[model samples]
Structure formats: structure tokens, C-alpha cells
Target chain A: MSNTPNRNRQLRSKLGRVRGLGSSHEGVHHWWAQRMSAMALLPLSLWFIFSLISLTGSDYVAFQSWVSEFGNSVFLVLFLVSMFHHAQLGLQVVIEDYVHSELWKMGLLLIVKYGSVLFAASGIFAVLKISLAG
Target chain B: MAEDDRPLSPHLQVYRPQITSVLSITHRATGVFLSLAAVMLTYWLASAAYGPDSFARAQAALESWFGRLILFGFTFSLFFHMCNGIRHLGWDLGWGFDLVKLRMTGVLVIISAFGLTVLSWVMAYSHVGKL
Candidate 1:
């Protein structure tokens, strides 16, 4: 009895068991993160847009001074991080849906993931540089 | 590639385009566009951080007619995505699932998206006294 495979466990084909090509069990996490980041982005994005509108007609110095404010720097960093995270998740779904070729899907996913992180980091670094160095 | 000959799942081409379907695809399309537009945002920030000369160059490029067009599109896409995203969130909570509600909200999303985009641009141009 102890050695017997459970009926449910025995239902899977041997190849299916070996391949493990089923739900990753992480889909819920992905879904939750996408929604959470999107929620964060709503307010952050609205604020950022209004701020940009306010900064219109302002010169480089004006923009720099705006970013140099402590609150502005913090919000900018938060916005960048959330925006990239949300964008990457959304793009991943898009590529996975449209790109049937396995190679293309994986390649595009990697590009979006890495590209998002790189851009987020660059934006954050720029914000910090302007805020702290000046 | 499969040897099977069976009816396939209905895809985009199979169904006649409707407002619901159009808005659904547009949500995704705008999302993809916004992802690419993020590069410009990063460029703007980095250039500003570097120095005034670089920032000026970035500004000039962004102020060009072509750049304004792209920016206008970006603005519209952002608002559309944001508005539709809220509708999605409502659906996630099991609200607004009825056909009537769905159509109403869908139209609302489109109207609000365009209204906000135009309003934002108006505010921007007015701020610069360019309108």
C-alpha cells in the first residue's frame, strides 16, 4: 500500500510525468503582480503626467530643479520601477500569445524582461543623479 | 503541422469585429506601444542628468514635428490603456460583467480616453502659451 502510486498520480502518462510540461504553479503570482503594479502605476502615472504638463515651457534648468526636489525624485523612481514592471508583464503576455514559434517567444520574452530592467535602472539612476548630485 | 483535421478554435479573423473586440485588441496594442515609448522617457531623463547640452539636444529632438506626433499618439495610448485597465479591474472583481454594462463601460472608456488626452494636451499647450 505504501509503495502503490495514488490513482490520481497514476493518471499522468509516463512522458507527461517526465516532461513536467504543465502549469508552472506561478501563474497566480504573475497575475497578482501585474495587477498590483498596475494599481500602483495608476496614481503614479497621473501625477507624473500632470507634473510634466506643469513643467512645460520650462528650460533644462527648470526640469532639473523639479527633479532635484526630494519628493519628485522619490515619486519618479517609484513611477519608473512600477511602469517597467507592469510593461514587462504586459509585453510577456502579448508575445506569448502572438508568437507561436518557441524560439521567437523565448527570445522576445528575454528581450522585454532585460530591456525593461535596464530602462528602469537607467531612469532611476538619472533621477537620483539629478536629485542628489545637484 | 498536426495530422489532425478538426474544427479549430475561433480566432480574430473568424469573428466579425465588434466594439468589445476592437477595444480589447486596442488595449493590447496600446500596451505594446507604451512599452516602446518608455525608451524615450528614459532618454529624456538620462539626457537631463548628463548636462544642459545633452538635455537641449533631447529637447530639440522631442520638440520636432515628428516627435510631437509621436508624443500625441503616446498620450492617447496611455490614456486609453489606463482607462481600459480600470474596466478590466472592475471585471476582475466580478462587476460589470453583463453585456449591457460591458458595452456601456467600453464606450465610456473610449470617450474618457479621448477627452483626457485632449484635455491634457490643451493644458500643456496653454501652459507654454503656444495655443
Candidate 2:
């Protein structure tokens, strides 16, 4: 996002493909999602830290009951979704940075994107299943 | 996409390691690590939702030395990421751009990470030895 030459080059992309990716592919969406998630996590993560602190000595029944609470379940769902979304974006940037092989890079990026979604879904499902049962 | 060999930007070999550089790079590494750790988080949640038996099994695994080590790493990484995340937000808000402030904040993040990790463990140990 900081590359002036890259932005200028991409700015020409709105006119049509001059070199490679267009302005449409400027990656602001990805950046915005990451930023938003970071903002969201600011409070959510604090809540999470306090919740875990409260659960520090809790037993299984305590944890089960705590998680079964409607508010806790809903907050957890939000946390998982935003956390995974932010994580996927971060990993995409990482793979793009270190993995020089274009094919491998693309493969890994796809895996990260899909994998985060799958895992986050599983996490949310777990939260819901427990909350519903209790 | 670049096929031609240009002079290229300076590589890691060109510069001495500093707290700023180290923390900057480790932030990415820890970010990637946390993403992978997210899988384990899912597993734990799934087990918890399953039943007492499954939760017990998961708890046993997490209580193991290997799992504890991993958890420690995860905890440390979380704190580091959190502190550095604040620093990033500062950058986004157009503050702390100066070299001195950057380096100071970098060191503070490192210290905060260790402090948080230690404090967490202490709290856990005082409460439940599970951590």
C-alpha cells in the first residue's frame, strides 16, 4: 500500500490493464478488512482476556455453563469470525512476501483463505452446539 | 513477474539486527504462527462442545508438556501481537513515526509481551495448575 510507483501503475489500471493488476485489485478491501478486524479485536480481545482470566480455575461444568450463556456464545462467534478473517489476510501477505514461487504462493494463499474459513466455521459451530445443548 | 535481474533492494545481510527490525519481522512470524494455532483453538472448542469425555481428552492433551509448551508460545505470541498491534495503530494514526519513538515502542512491546506471559502463568498457577 505504501509503494507510490505501484499505486501509480495501478492507477493506470482503471483505464484498462496497462501492466498487470488494475486499480480494482488495489487490495484496499483486504487492507480494510484487516484494519477493521484489528479495531474490532481491540475490545473483543480484552473481553476474551478477562473471560479467560475468570475461567482460570474453572472446572468443566463451570466452563460449560459459562460458554452456554447466550451473550458469551454470540461474542465468541464474533471473535472467531473476525479473528479468522484478519488472520487470513495477514497470512496472505506473509505467503506473498516470503514465497517467491508464484505457483506455490498462489496455492498456499488459497489454502490459507479456505482453511481459516473452515476452522472458524468449526469453532463457531462448536460454540453454538455447546450453547444450544446447555 | 519480474524476470530481469535488477540491482534489487538491500537484503538482510546488508544491515545489522536491531530491536526495531527484529520485532517488525517477528510480528509477521507470530501472526502466521497464531493463524496456525487457530486450528488448535478450533479443536479445543469442538472437543468442549462434544461432551465430558471429549473435553477431558482434550484437556489431558493440553495438560501435557508438549501442549503446555505450545500454549506458552501461543500466549507469548498473543501478547506480542497485541502490544505491537497498538504500535501499528499508532502508526496508522500518524503518530510515533520518529526513529527514537519507534525503537522505544519496539522495546516496550517486547517487555510487555514477557510481562504479560509471566503474569498470565503466575495467575494460572495460583488458580489452577492446568496452565
Best by TM-score: 1
**Candidate 1 per-residue lDDT over residues A1-134, each given as its tens digit:** 37676755565567656775445634367888999998998999899889989998889888989999989999999999999999999999888777777789899999999999999999999999988877
Off by over 4 Å in 1: A1-22, B1-10
Candidate 2 Cα outliers beyond 4 Å, as residue runs: A1-24, B1-10, B129-131
A1-134 per-residue lDDT for model 2 (tens digits): 57466545533544455334446566356767888999998788768766876787566788889999988998899989988998998998878667777799899999998899899999999999988888
CA shift of B42, model 1, Å: 0.5
Tens-place lDDT digits, model 2, residues B1-131:
55535343346667899887788889988988888677887898999998989998988898899988998898888889989999998998999999999999998999999998888777777666555
Prediction 1 TM-score vs. true = 0.89
For model 1 the interface RMSD, in Å, equals 1.8
Summing lDDT over every window of 10 consecutive residues in candidate 1 chain B, give the lowest-scoring window.
Answer: B1-10
Residue B15 of model 2 has an lDDT of 88
Tell me how far the alpha carbon of residue A110 in candidate 1 is from the true structure, in angstroms, after superposition: 0.9
DockQ of 2: 0.61
User: What lDDT score is found at residue A60 in candidate 2?
Assistant: 77
